[model samples]
Target: MSSFSADTPHSSSVMGRIFIYGILLIVAGYFLLPLLVMVFTSVKSMEEIRTGSLISIPTSITFDAWSKAWSSACTGVECSGLSGYFWNSVWLVTPTVSISTFLGALNGYVLTKWNFKGADVFFSMLLIGCFIPFQVILLPMARTLGFLGLAGTTTGLIMVHIIYGLAFTTLFFRNFYVSIPNELVRAAQIDGAGFFMIFWKIMLPLSIPIIVVSVIWQFTQIWNDFLFGVVFSAGESQPITVALNNLVNTSTGVKEYNVDMAAAIIAALPTLFVYVVAGKYFVRGLTAGAVKG
Candidate 1:
């Protein structure tokens, strides 16, 4: 048989694969259509947004809505805008992510290496806290904070986030450490390394992936949080998510749909940006550690 005869089937297979990819691309576009529409509308003038079909390209692109969303948009008497909430979210998310990730690492380390009589019970209780809805805890948490005189304060909100972020962060890191070889820890101990020393030097280095996972998860949760932020951090301390809600939820003379959409996009941008930057690390981290447990 000629070599050309064999090459013909190979060419056909390649063409079939290409056809499959083309179909998948079309399906992906279908799923992304709404997001595309939102982006287009966010940049369009209000008149263009009102007059044109949602999917149509704008005749005149304007940054007015974005500008309004950032700095001058009115939410009640406060027209200083979403930037205030943006900075507040940044402050909240940073400490929340750091503290939660650190505590999760500590929890995982303790769970994996140290066994006590009631360790399982303690861990179970913590895990149970995860299953309970935040709404259930919200009232009690509020009352407790108020009793402590931390209500409607930034510190109170941070404490609430650290509490909430604990469940998932601890779970993720514990599962990760479960996959790690016990022999490695024993070997480190034989070298006369203490618990904190071993964790800081040996285990923590290997835990970069899990830390990334915890940080990303906590960051998104805290940034997008509205209920906790609303209940705990009112006024100037409210996170961007709360501001976005107030912006879109108000009864102005006329509702600014374009501005609302723009504000929604703006409020989401930080978490979106974080994911875009660290998403690869998240996948890599989970895959590296998830199989061990």
Candidate 2:
């Protein structure tokens, strides 16, 4: 009877685990199916796409669509493809991410370690920036951009991204830093270390996981930003997202679904690659940030 009771609980646990796993697998499939279909469609010729179901695999895979999407597809009167816009994004994202992440780290360190009277109020004000809808600020921002003579320029776009991105990055780093022991900062101060010294030596080093998380988050956010890219930039300064939009919505030609899919995949690849490479770090940062506080 004792052995049978033990075996019954073991069987029940196994069944429970199997049930949970089955649900998770189903959810994963639901999300991944669209990506799979996009890839399948990207590699197929137009003739094959018309004949096959949307989700069906290509009869023969071809790179022609991808090649054209990257190098020869039309956007407006320009057929220069996604390359120019892609590089424009790269230029815009790199500086914006770096500046925002660094500023966020600095803001967080100051708020947490060097805090003074009214710091909470100030921080609260900063946090409000995160909740304010982008739409509410669009006209004001556009006016500001024009006033600064940055409208429709890459520099202007970078500035816009950095400003919006700062709130989230600061929130991330501040929350993460709040969970860190104050004693460490105090000890460093007692040891004759200055603000910059302590930050560079201790806080920054200990912040690797969060830094990775911040960078990846900022990178993805800035890279994939369509609304800001479109609104803040134009002509040669427009990013790939805007270019992809023009490619898809061009009124002058028969839409090439395959090329559109390929362009989307190309546009999506950088963010996806960043996440895949640093996914472990991203998970660890979230876990640490959650549990520490």
Quick one: best lDDT, which candidate? 2
Name model 2 segments beyond 4 Å from true. 1-24, 283-293
In order, the Cα lDDT scores of the candidates are: 0.82, 0.88
Determine which window of 10 residues in candidate 1 has minimal summed lDDT.
284-293
Please, what are the lDDT tens digits per residue for candidate 2 over residues 112-145? 9999999899888987887787999899999999
lDDT of 2 at 67: 95
Give a tens-digit lDDT track for model 1, residues 1-112: 3335573554346677799889999999999897788788888887887789989987888888889888988876688779988898888888888998899899988998
How well does candidate 1 match the true structure, expressed as C-alpha RMSD? 4.2
Provide the TM-score for each candidate, comma-separated: 0.87, 0.89
Q: How far off is residue 42 in model 1, in Å? A: 1.5
Off by over 4 Å in 1: 1-27, 281-293
Pairs in steric clash, model 1 = none
Against the true structure, whose TM-score is highest?
2
Give per-residue lDDT, candidate 2, residue 189. 96
